[model samples]
Target: MNTATIDTSPIRILRRPEVEKRIGLGRSTIYLHMQQGTFPKPIRLGSGGAAAVGWLEHEIDAWLHEQVSKSRVSSTRA
Candidate 1:
C-alpha cells in the first residue's frame, strides 16, 4: 500500500445533538427525514445491550450542499 497515495480523510461521527446543531433541525425532524428516505441514515454503534447512533460527517456535509444548491436554484428561478 502506497501511504502517500492513500485517501486520508478522517471519519468524523456526529451524534444527534451535534447533527441537529450543525443542520439546524430538531431531533424529530431529523428522524422524520430519515424515515422518509430524504436524509442519510446514522451508523449504529456499541453493543447489543447498549447501542448508540451517529452520522458520518461527510454524508451530512453532502446533504447540506445539496440543500444549498436547491435553495440557490429556487431563488434564481424566483
Candidate 2:
C-alpha cells in the first residue's frame, strides 16, 4: 500500500495581485478588511522600499478557513 503526504511548511509569499486572485477580493476591499483588523497584515519584505511587497501564504490560508467557518455558522443559524 502507498500513501501520500502533504508538506505544511510556510513557503510561498504571495504578492497583492496573487492574493487578490486567490481570495476574489478587490484592492480596496483588501485594504478595508485589513484596516478592520479582520485580515492578515502583510510583512515588510525589504528595508526602505517604497512599494509594499510581502505576504505569508499560511496567514492567507488561515483567513480562508476563518471565512469558511463563518459561512458555515451563518448557514446553520438560518
Candidate 3:
C-alpha cells in the first residue's frame, strides 16, 4: 500500500516588517537587495489573486550568519 508523504520540517515565515526588524534594514534596502539578488526573495503567502509575501525564517538566519562570516573573513585579511 502506498501512502501520501508529508513534510514534517518546522517552517517559520517572517513578514516584511519582522524581516526588517531581524536584519536591521529598511524596507527599501530589502527590496533593493532582493532586486540585486543579494537577499533571499520572499515567497507568496497568499493565493488566489493575493499579493502577500513572506521570507522563510531559516533563509534570513542563514543570510545573517553569512554576513557575519564575511565580515570576519574580510577583516582578517587586513
- Candidate with maximal lDDT: 3
lDDT of 1 by residue, 1-78 (tens): 655786678899999999999999999999999999999999988877569999999999999999999999999999
Whole-model lDDT values for every prediction: 0.95, 0.90, 0.96
Name the lDDT value of residue 11 in candidate 2. Answer: 87
Report the lDDT tens digits of candidate 2 across residue range 1-78: 658888767588999999999999988999999999999999887778586776799899999999999999999999
lDDT of 1: 0.95
User: After superposition on all CA atoms, how large is the RMSD of candidate 2?
Assistant: 5.6
Deviation from native of the Cα of residue 3 in model 3, angstroms = 14
**Candidate 3 per-residue lDDT over residues 1-78, each given as its tens digit:** 779889899999999999999999999999999999999999998786778999999999999999999999999999
Residues forming the 10-long window of minimal summed lDDT in candidate 2 = 46-55
TM-score of each: 0.87, 0.83, 0.85
Q: Which pairs in model 3 have colliding backbones? A: none
State, as a TM-score between 0 and 1, how close model 1 is to the true structure: 0.87
- Identify the runs in model 1 with alpha carbons over 4 angstroms from their true place: 1-6
Best by TM-score: 1
